[model samples]
Target: MAYRTWQCENCGFLYEEEFGLPLEGISPGTRWEDIPDDFVCPTCGFAKSQFSMIEI
Candidate 1:
């Protein structure tokens, strides 16, 4: 699978699908689409809508 990286528009926090935020309860390999809508950025506490898919 091609994992994607999502960036927080508020704080530039990167959420890599290949390495989910385990400390935030999101397991590794979790897909971006699978994440809940209510999920917030761990760094800035911004909503999921604040994130944008980033190509790397």
Candidate 2:
């Protein structure tokens, strides 16, 4: 599986994980493409573009 990194729009929280099925209680059957571009940050409800991909 491929790994992906995601940044938080609110507090700039960077998170990384393997690409696979979504975790329980967080997202249901959520794929990379399925995620909405206007998705809001869980902590501060910021827009999706506010998040940046973290390159390792």
Model 2 CA lDDT for position 17: 47
- Residues 1-56 of candidate 1 have per-residue lDDT tens digits of 78999999989999999999999999999999899999999989999998999998
Which number leads on lDDT?
1
Residue 28 displacement (Å), model 1: 0.7
lDDT per residue, candidate 2, 1-56, as tens digits? 46567787569854444533244223533444556676666667787678777776
RMSD of each: 0.8, 3.9
Estimate every model's Cα lDDT from 0 to 1: 0.95, 0.59
Worst lDDT 10-window in candidate 2: 20-29
